[model samples]
Target: MIQLYYAPGNANLAPHMLLEELGVPHELILVDRDNHVHRGAAYRKLNPNGLIPVLIDGDLVLYETAAICLHLADTHPEAGLVPPLGSAERAHCYKWLMHLTNTVQAEMITYFYPERMVDDAAAGAQVKAHAEARLAQMFDLIDAELAGGGPYLLGAQFSVVDPYLFMLARWSRMMVRPARNRPALGQYLERMAARPAVVRAFAAEGIAAPFC
Candidate 1:
């Protein structure tokens, strides 16, 4: 059975949603993050980076959230969570996934953990503010894409990118200019929030309302 090491509302949410959407049997191993278990040697053995999520599938141990999402979608191609390989849609899927992780998620890390980059609390506040501003622009671009694309990121097809985007967008709920504040993105979030698979994932993660 697949075992996923996770913390509630962590990056693991994307893969968790995909797993629920696929209706696959898997084990959820809650990481004791509050006690710094993720930083301990046992957890580090699974993920040297000590990230919140580490998916163990047979002999394969995966850490990165996007990679885990892609792996699940690829393994369960019948789910249609990813586009046909080598197609333009697949390329776009890769593009959005990359942009979400490398760009949006990276900026979010800065926004949430600015103290890691700055020496002073004041400087950390500035870093977080700037990151939030950049995240707003990124979400605006995504909102425009949805405005033109009609529903999902891949033009009406619900792919791995949707849940991934939802997980990231949920992090912005407390921001000054949240991703949900935009008309198109707000509607998009509501649609995602209504998904049965998404609901199950959120519930499993013990995530409360205001999910956007």
Candidate 2:
């Protein structure tokens, strides 16, 4: 069985949701980030960076949300969380996944928790403004993508992309300029939030409903 060390209401929610979606047998260990549980010596042994969403599967241990999501998808191809290699759609999935992790996720971190990235309040505010603008643009792009009548990111078929996109969309609400204006994106969020896997993830973490 796999063991996932995570915290509620954090980026770790992405992998937690993915694990739930996959129906994988795993142990969920709650780490108290506020209390510095991740910073402890023992916890650091698992992940020197002190990040949440650390997955321990037998002798293998992994960190980073994107890497964890992809690993689970690859390990369980029957779950259909990812597309197979060499397919056009697979390329598209990889493209968006990278974009979400490198672009949208990074911008969100800067805007949502500027203190972690910079010390100057004025500089932080400026950077946050830029991030907010980029977020708005990204939300518009997502809305357009889903506007093609998607019950999921890649149309009718759901994959790990949905969970990853859902996580980023949820983070958008925390931004200074929320994505509430995008009706399609807003409705998409509602659908993802209603998924049983997502519900269980929030409940497990003792967090309120994400869409609520």
For residues 16-117, what per-residue lDDT tens digits would candidate 1 score against the true structure? 999999999999999998899999999999999999799999999999999999999888889898888789999999999999999999999999999999
What's each prediction's clash count? 0, 0
Query: What are the lDDT figures for the candidates, one per model?
Result: 0.92, 0.84
Q: In model 2, which runs have C-alpha deviations exceeding 4 angstroms? A: 116-119, 210-212
Q: What residue pairs clash in candidate 1, if any at all?
A: none
| Weakest ten-residue segment in model 2 by summed lDDT | 172-181
**Ten contiguous residues with the weakest lDDT in model 1:** 201-210
Q: Write down the TM-score for model 2.
A: 0.92
